[model samples]
Target: MHMKFIGLLLAATLLLRCQPSSSVDPITTGPEPEPYRIVRDSIKTGTYLGIAIDEQAASVYPKIQALQATKGVSALNVVSNVFADLIALKERLPLYQYILLDQKSGTDSGVQITVEGKTVKSIYLNSGQQLTQWPEKQAVDSSVRVGDAISTLYDKLVAIRNIDRYTNKFEYISLMTKNLSADYDGGMSQSPQWYFGFSTGPNQMDQIQVHFRGGKVSKLYIDHYSKY
Candidate 1:
């Protein structure tokens, strides 16, 4: 009887230790957790836009870094930023069509988040008075992944940047379009090769060219940036 009781005690102790910290314990069993799910149908769209005030604007990057630094968002302060109030950021998975805000209008700038996957397809800054437009509707095809789509888009955007008013040797610069064109006013610069912003400016020399691979862009060789 003593041996049997000792064996039972050890088994019970092991089982108790294995008991999950949370009652819901979706990770161990039960329905999927709020913030974690396997998105089916292949394509889902989610956009998070935030506008920051003066000091807050610069804090945006730091906030993101801090939140990530914690390894996990166990604490709230590590999660909240002037631009984003990620209070309930957890307990919820990436859903389609969502907007998060700290305070709409401010002195500094706002942020836009459009990610098909881990890859950022679009990012924008909101200047005061300027309206941030979230497309009411967007088309998402079954691309292998967001990275592939961005690679495709980057290639196309680069090609578009190649054609310049200056001497053309066919060079291109790869860029983060959403960030660079956040203001949308756009600009152009030249030295080794020409670079153009949003609105296609008049070419000083060769006709600007944009290469496309089907609906998605493939490869680009801008004259200035593209060593290609």
Candidate 2:
């Protein structure tokens, strides 16, 4: 009986030894990197496309006239000569009900400006479109204009760490490619590190997205928001 008991005890001890340990090593990993920033507040005041928020239509007309002459391949037939004419006449005559800058023609890509009391109210620049032959200046910073290269934009802006925070490294590397073929059509630069802000409404924020098309900045414009 004693010998049998000893054998059973040894077998039980072996079984226990074969079981996994109840205590486990904690998983070890590095801290997650910070996410890419985005402009959170509305931007109310700034100059865009050479026009200020409250600038009179008459004061900005001459500049518009000049810009009309420089219409690029994207803007042709989109904004008719009547646009300049209406602005010219609307200064003295009430020929139109309201002045709205919209791109009904073309690829439905362009800047849309809303005017109230003959003053520019809101502006939304779509990176999907390029309207003028000459690059338009950013309202906040004229030094940073549309149609520039992504490399150029990085050089002009302040030091911004973790540019790929919003996107993975592989995707960011693809965007930084030079003059990507037209067959490769889509690109975006939404890292708040790259955007400029504007005050659009109370508690609302706006941003100028430095959008890229074919590896060049196609447009830079304030996204006027109404959110409070």
Best by lDDT: 2
Tens digits of per-residue lDDT for model 1, 145-186: 223333343232223223352112112111111122122211
Cα distance off (Å), candidate 2, residue 228:
5.2
lDDT of 1 at 197: 14
lDDT for 136 (candidate 1): 17
* Model 1 segments more than 4 A misplaced: 1-85, 97-104, 128-228
Backbone clash count, each prediction separately: 15, 11
Query: What lDDT is obtained when candidate 1 is compared to the true structure?
Result: 0.22
